[model samples]
Target chain A: MKNILFFTGRELTVEEMQEPIPDLHHFAVQPGVSDEPKCQRCGNETNFSSHPCARCGKECLYCRNCIKMGKISSCTTLYRWTGPEPDVPKAAGILHWSGTLSPGQKTASDNVLQAIQQQKEHTVWAVAGAGKTEVLFAGIATALSEGRRVCIAAPRSDVVRELAPRLQNVFPNTPPAALYGGSPDRHTYSPLVISTTHQLFRYTAAFDVMIVDEVDAFPYTFDHSLQYAVQKARKTESALIYLTATPEPSWREDIQSGKRDATLIPARYHRQPLPVPSMKWCGNWKKSIVPPAVLEWVKTKEKALLFYPHIETMEKALATLKAIDSRIESVHAADPLRKEKVAAMRRGEVPVLLTTTILERGVTFPGVDVAVVGAEDRVFTESALVQIAGRAGRSADCPTGEILFFHYGKTTAMVQSIEQINEMNKLGRQKGLLDT
Target chain B: MNRCLLCENGTEVDSWRAFFGAKAPPLCEVCTASFNRLSGPCCHVCSRSLEEDGECTDCQSWRKSIFHSNVSLFHYNEAMQDVIAQFKYRGDYVLASIFAEKIRTEAKKAACDLICPVPLAPSRLAERRFNQSEALIVCAGLTAAPLLGRHESEKQSKKSRAERMNAVQTFYPTGEATGKSVLVIDDIYTTGATMRLVADALADAGAASVKSITIARSGS
Candidate 1:
């Protein structure tokens, strides 16, 4: 039944269910947070609190980490379905994308398919604009054909929203259920699921193949609970595909030491090298007025995205930039007009968009130059700088664009981002993936 | 690092001051600003924000009521609604601390002999895992006197204002209330129906006076 399918892989509290089912699996909501306490839903070991419970009339320990998903206390009962797995119709001729994959994408796609078939963990260390999503199409199609559930989880809702339609276009026969906070398709059951990583807290062993896009993106790379959610959302023996433009330093070492399996695509599908950021010393842009170097860069009249460390600084600078051009807009994560501003930039209505690091990735603005006003700020991590540079030179017609890093003093992230870009370019040329 | 209980942002406080004081403030400045404190020209009886200083319509209608007055701290705006939902409905007990200081101040001003939390029905208690009123009292460093027991009734949140007014009294005295000034503590004073019912029951039990203090007061 549709109702049973909804509960197939979900862990819901008794109260959330409204009424107790006749026969199903039930477990202690909180698994004793006293001795090495951990949240069963999110696997958060810390951030636990206790209060006197009226249900059991005892002190109940609850997890504060995943409380946003609804509180899970020691006194509550969590229900799951231990019955037979729901019947998922095998989807054939699922992938309908007509676009062809480049040689680099083809190799990575083959590796992804192999990983899915063998149920092994693999990483796709592809550069930004390298068509990483296309690499997953074959594997997802193969998995769905076998009647196995697949999940493509991203760290941010923005990425999930951007990915859902593209995946739906390719897999026409199997429309993936997209899940996020306040999403309309909450209870839809489908073979393929596209969801934000936060939504995975309610799922348990739901996917046969789990693909985590933007694995190095914020709150995913920083928050350990998101990683735990990915692990928990997958079956006991399932394949994992970690897609990221820049992996963490430790993961790079693991790839080199042969401890992890990986496939690297160093070039974009356009066969052009990534734009390397050039650092220019601009003294004290925060305290003083917008530096002359930044002014000169803006005067070039190329549609650009100027990244700032914080929203306050970006908004303060917006007035000066708007004096130069009224069409210039500023946006941040909390800005209600974020989507509209980004769209305005995409439509080339805005000359330059000043923003915080929220716009560093998962957005494509073709033929736009990129610059970081405060490249020395700690918020601009190495991967962030690289992703910011990747925003340029995306469209094949205009295969090259400038990336400027204007700063008081270049930080290690700036130097490393440039080095990584050059290294990827070098590798791309050597592998014949780039037009030298 | 001390994080805010509401927003989870790092709460910056002087270390020495916190070390010397009872405890650091539980919320950051931004989150604290979201709570709209009741101030200037509120109703004398129910503390509802009014254009001029006088009793509100609801309090005016309760001219024959037994309770003297109700003092509430914050206006039941959207932020207070979310706070109450998290604390009472979602069972996030730690959120009760957000209102601790304000509740403590209000309760002290009331100066009642007995601090009584409006009891929840046994079924509601079993579902929510804690009596939110009791949690508010205890978290505010005030001892709660379980002076009332609630009979099984439909949830007040599910009922309309007219229905709540016409509904039968649900609370009965569980402890001695003779000649005692009772200050009833509840999370939100919505319709004044539940509070008046509790006050009537306490009055029937021969309490000297009944005054109430709530964290938030909804404009009925």
Candidate 2:
């Protein structure tokens, strides 16, 4: 019998067995929602799945933690071919990208290549729009040349969607397979794979080179199960690279404590300073949006993202903000037309979008001014505020824009968000990497 | 560690403890407010809560029915749906304990010769490992005796309200009843079809009387 692997590594009963032929081996899937039924996204395994799931109709002991990437339940099953190694994903490929990395990107890119070659774990602490993906092209190319399988994963599907085409463009000879929840190429195997970290649940010691983008993003920042997924999905000798524009303070502590190796790229690819957020008291925004201040800011930009603390409140704010511009629209995770709404914004048809924290990261619009309605809400944490600010000045053409926080009261998150950007910019200047 | 079965929001102490006495449900405050209990005037036959002080149309058929009366603890709402879904479908048997306590408090009304759980098919028994209603009876510190049996049939969950209300009789007594009074217990009273069938089977076995108890009843 061909070797097969079960999702959650469960002990297959006789009834579930299609045929018990020679060499048939069953795996005991771990018993955990976070630990066993690993979230295919941020990999957090909190004990919150105590609610009965509607899907499996079983008390599904797996991770019931609500996530954008789909919930993992005990009934959710993933099968893998463990009969024999499917003859490694070897393919013919040559570097075909025409774009060259900047001097800073070149240094980080070289460091990544050297670390991956030695099978050592490393972190690429690049700022937003620091050409972080480009820094991986060289390292990936070198790995492919040596016939090692490579996988690039991120907590958000958008990052995987964004990275796949770029990686495929750079390595035209070796097309990268993109895997997400509903991805059509889920079963297909390729030498180069780009997938959301959640899809890593089906793999076990599979890749030789693993690159995780947006390591500090939602579902990924605090979730240890995703880290567990990363570890289980790669070979023991594989090189794992954590890429994040905003590294958590704990990571800084690790680097300072000499517990981890890191390459910190403080400046953007264009060498411009990160745009710092300026807080403006709008006085209890739970009551209203100060139209004059917001109108003045929106009047300068072609597009803007106005953030909210909750869905119910965002709907109310969306109604009020519609007076500012008829072209304004709203989107959230539950909105069926969310894709179309975001596409309209990208085409510059919509001038303003009222959204919740769902769009805090893994989304970028060039030179788009951004603002937070209630910066004091606990939902807007320091890291989240930092990612929201990172959305500004993303495009090379528009390297600077306004990042404002209209708050009922100035919050520590607001202050720390500004401090984090300023600190990075200061480090950039100290290293002589910034234009100003 | 006492995660409220309803809204997963509050700590077990300050949140759940804030509502003490008879109002202290095994749920958080927000969820406690959503709990629809079967209080006030109800149909004497089916125990369904009513706006008036008489029997409901479904229970008005009690004159032609085999079951003498039925009692339920809660009106099936969204909270009950999740609770029952966890118990019946997800097979989170532990959830049965919550209902067990409530049923035990109410079981004083069901003094009978023996308490019988609505039987489950052997296939479902193998898959789920335990019948949900049986777990409720066992956990209530009551001795659950097997008084009925049924062949493997279509599960009631897959049926619509109309289908369940008119479901053909499937249950039969496992042994002779011989004028003995019995109480039938189930997880949820959806359209009263399962209870009707079980009660009818007990009546056919020459039982003197049949009564039914359920944790929650379909309010819709």
Candidate 3:
């Protein structure tokens, strides 16, 4: 029965299944990747290749794009449990969070709850550090009370990791299954699931309420396969809520034109404005010594975060910065000690941590001044710059901090990031959500 | 807008290479560097890395080895293991193209009259959809002479070293192996048990000489 529950909402191959079932539905694995080729799993259409298949004894086409998940060859069969759906019990006291939400978060949270009840698509365009995760708690609790499955998916694994404990703590009665590439709870069956967007490829019509956080983040925004997976993971008549600090330009236009329904939270939970980044010209910071302004900021003895465009530049800068202060360290995506470094910084051990755009979002340090060494780099998009600035002024005790953009030349993204912050501040003030 | 097949990163195609109508390299420089090329002193029989120019311990124990020698391009290191897993177990058929140029060079160097891929059992072939060795040979733009057939047996990965070495011969020659130099191609040469059995079958079929080329050679 437990095995049956595990396969209830999943489409798996025979080799992937551990137990044998009495009756199961079968579908073509490749499913016409040749004539009008399209991948059933990731919805990839362009990248397809054919190979001599031993099962069919002919050249069969397969989708190369989603081959990482497991090759779905033309002759293979995909199995699914077509019996009755798993019966999930409604739990009492699903949400145990005692913290109060700000007025902006309340409005957005109410909108999310309403969308779930109506089974409609909605967007929560909340500012960073605006208690975005808290807004989803109310909606998730409602969905759980009705015995409906709910999933909160994010583009990056870091976001999923950050949200897992918080969701687990609040939902004390119903433990959530945190899913990623190497998650231990991959086989767990739970009403509430927190997973990376890429993990949804194994699920089909699994969740009744699918909440996609950080929807505009990279790899999810640029990759169509992830977008298709999100759509396929949820039931046909399900609530889809998109949560983002910075929505894309096209989405923003739709919101403005009233074509898309959205709730905007313009202020942080602390009721303080997002720290605007001030531009500074640091001449040839790459080829020359460390900038004088950065050195001066280091002299202040306050904890800070310095961002560079590339890992090479960051490592080079780390050499000079470490000479000045022995405790300074740098981290990148591939650094094996990334977790230890980040944990040390959170414990107030590392004074200045140099990093790449991997830390642009989903990280917070109280009362730390932030600086972008190469703000004009193409990697620093308008959304990225805004998220980097949001890293400051997070904690209520330290709701104001300095943000500096030290660049050789300012790009349009830099200017737009500043303008977007100011625009949000103005809106917060108009809505009486920010302190005068 | 060519992308590396392994890393999916955008690969830079030089104008000169594109001007000569050469196919874009399947891997980028970073991905290419991860594969440790087999070099230095190696076993003359199995191509395993050795301290000096001599036969490895496994080759020394062979009582009646029929194959002349085995040539491998890369070490079966962690990176090569990952590549083989994705290409074979995962059925990413296009990934066979990554070894095309290297296999071509090795095959030419072997200079055998016929190139034969170690065959897969009928049931195993039906399950995996394609024979990895056959795909490797075909992708390298070489004709794969289906000169051998294999009987159903337990997977090599599932068996222990002793079990694999002592297993009965499974391969039987099927094509014209009489009086012709045959070169057997396979994806990996682990323990050399499978290759030995394959070579024995070819030799029994009256082949002039049997040589082998593998993409990777395991340390064992």
Lowest summed lDDT window (length 10), candidate 3 chain A:
A25-34
lDDT tens digits, residues A1-436, model 1?
A: 6667677677776655634354544332334233467777788887877898877778889988888788877665566667777766766437798899999999999999999999999999999899999999899889988878899999888788888888888888877789999888787777788999999988888889999998888889879999999998899999999998999999999987989899999999999888888999999999854798888888786589999998888888898888988999999998999999999999999999998989888888889898899899998889889999989998898878999999998788989999999999999999999876
The residue-by-residue lDDT of candidate 3 on A224-325, one tens digit each, is 899888999999999999999999999999998999999999999999998889999988887754688777776675588998989988888888888888
- What DockQ does predicted model 2 obtain? 0.11
Per-residue CA lDDT of model 2 for A298-325, tens digit only, reads 6566688988889888887667767767
Q: Rate the local accuracy (lDDT) of all candidates.
A: 0.86, 0.75, 0.86
Q: Model 1's DockQ?
A: 0.66
User: Which residue pairs overlap in candidate 3's backbone?
Assistant: none
Count of backbone collisions within predicted model 2: 15
lDDT, residue A340, candidate 3? 97
Output the number of the DockQ-best candidate.
Answer: 3
For every model in order, the TM-score on chain A comes to: 0.95, 0.83, 0.96
lDDT of residue A381 for candidate 2: 90
Q: TM-score, each model?
A: 0.90, 0.77, 0.91
Better of 1 and 3 by lDDT: 3
iRMS value of model 3?
1.0
Q: What is the lDDT of residue A427 in candidate 2?
A: 90
